[model samples]
Target: MKATQALTTALKAELRRAGITYAQLAVHLDLAESSVKRIFSRGELTLARIDQVLALLQLDFVDLAREVAQATPARQALSAEQEAAVVADPHLLLVAICVQAHWTAAQILETYAITHAQLVAALTVLDRLGFIELRAHNRYRLKVDQTFRWRPDGPVMAFFRQHAVPDYFEGGFDGPGEQLALVHGQIAHARAADFHDRLQRLAQDFVHQHVADQVRPAGDKTAYTLVLGMRSWLFEPFRTLLRMPGAAPGIAPRAQARR
Candidate 1:
């Protein structure tokens, strides 16, 4: 999804640089301006159409790919003030979340009750915030990396923890491409660190695959969230049973007493 999004953003940026309007693109492609807009907004353009647009822009797929490679890595975490700005406005916060998911202006407008002007305004605010660069036809380039994350315990995450968490877990995990897993064990500190490193690599791989799958058609895509976490914890019931001073090792206090 990231690749397609990047291509669309690059095309828009090139179009702005070339001062080519959707109407001009329609003329070049012998399509309606609305059709051209739809194509770019949905990012469902075929390779031939993409090439056609690139030809009009005097560029090619390699150029777009290179631009994507150069830009995708620049997306890093937003500063605290920037995040605070987002959480300040409900619409801005919504827009930020949608953009993080690679949602185009059209997608957000279609999916939400936001008007075109409202969405454009949000994009403009994001542009000013350095979260994205607004381009012609209201398209944008993501300023953050694909692996961009909310600051740990930051306002954004605090919001998610308070609201998005319960909503997220409401999923049944029974549908196609859905899953949930839990495992508990005690391990050496070094081994725990190694496990965390592996989880980080796995997250990176998932992000890569997300970009790779952008080639698939929209109909073939389904939004999925992967929540990975690890922590030292015990069931609440087991907590009270923990061994006390001089208690039998690995035995609950009550059980040890009974023995």
Candidate 2:
């Protein structure tokens, strides 16, 4: 993950993203396909040669650097200490969630009541914890990707379980696009895995739709949280009759209304 290696990796990614094959790049660079492959494999191209590649891709060095920066993240799952620091202050926790949603400082200021100084302080702490990369003018870049997730039993999730959960479930869920359901059943392990895979794809589709709806006007959009859960569990009363009274096991299939 050295600087040179990162740049080379980004170059390769750009080529793939643009659907430009090595053979095509060979023609563009006026070199043999094997030679082009060797140069990419070794990542031993001169600055001029790299510039030529960038020209063919219609991208500049800055774009490649940005891609490299994005490809490199502050590893998934923060240490316990980091999670504790985030939950130490409620305002900081709110800011952290906003950052996870890619909210800009100005947008946060417009929506939340936190002071500008407080926001900056929280951003500084996140940068120190390697959760984000703070930049000038209160700008920052999220240091995690879609695969990034909170430690299940970490302090942040514990905080949510103790606080946010109550608030979240307090809703009626009878309103438009809201729902609450509970089901119990048993299924084979392999089918359960397939169920998990489909649930993951549904979650990803929700994410894609969120991104696509970002262009809508604020008035035309309403914030909604989609909580997905699949586990082998039965009602406590029912579980009391099962073999393992203290644990829940197996799975069942449930229908989604709109998904």
Candidate 3:
């Protein structure tokens, strides 16, 4: 499916799971119920209106955009020749490593086992591409606005951390502790599906609530499109991996006892 369509589908599903009727959403947005219905039915809302909804529902646009982008198939598949081109570019490797939550050149070199000159060359290329900026002599920070398209073999963790993870779960929780709380709550209630469902709804409600307030009567209708997409492939695997009895010692009390 197209990125826009995928995002709209995810957003609509989220609204449904929230038990928030169109009328209630309308009231919250201070718009006519019919208009809210039209927006939901059309699955298109102005970015400004979306902002309003996001503020109300406490969702982040960057996260939603990341989800959509990740779920959307690449516009053009990489042929062998194209793949070779990316592989030839040493900077791509540096870009990949910097995309992680917190990484440095020294750490990258140590982890990847590369020489100082090789690391410096890679960082220089990445800096030139605007994918990264030098924070200090050897320190760098990722530019979240930049878009990257590299081979799948080129560090999937960096791709997901820099791109996907930030997009879907942004603002839902501030830290790992908050995320663990949400996950634990879901497990405690035996509602993993519900937890996922609620997350989707939260994103939609946030957009709707915001858009209704910010959008002017004569605003550009075409400019308003809410795109919400998620990458289950990237995250679900990690979730499953972490949930294994061997992964969480405290949580897997039964498994520990059996041992």
Best candidate (score: lDDT) = 2
lDDT (Cα atoms) of all candidates against the true structure: 0.75, 0.78, 0.49
TM-scores for all candidates: the values are 0.66, 0.69, 0.27
Which candidate leads in TM-score?
2
Off by over 4 Å in 3: 1-87, 145-259
RMSD of each: 10.5, 8.2, 16.9
Give residue 146's lDDT in candidate 2 (0 to 100): 51
Q: Rank the candidates by lDDT, best first.
A: 2, 1, 3
Write model 1 residue lDDT over 99-211, tens digit each, in one string. Answer: 76666677788889988888888899999998887766675667887668889878898888998888887767778767776666667778877887777787778777765
Candidate 3 residue-wise lDDT, 70-132, digit = tens: 443322233345444434655554444454223556546666666777777766665565545
TM-score of 2: 0.69
Which runs of model 2 end up more than 4 angstroms from their true locations?
A: 1-70, 243-259
Among residues 3 or more apart in sequence or in different chains, the pairs in candidate 1 whose N, CA or C atoms overlap within 3 Å are 75-144, 75-145
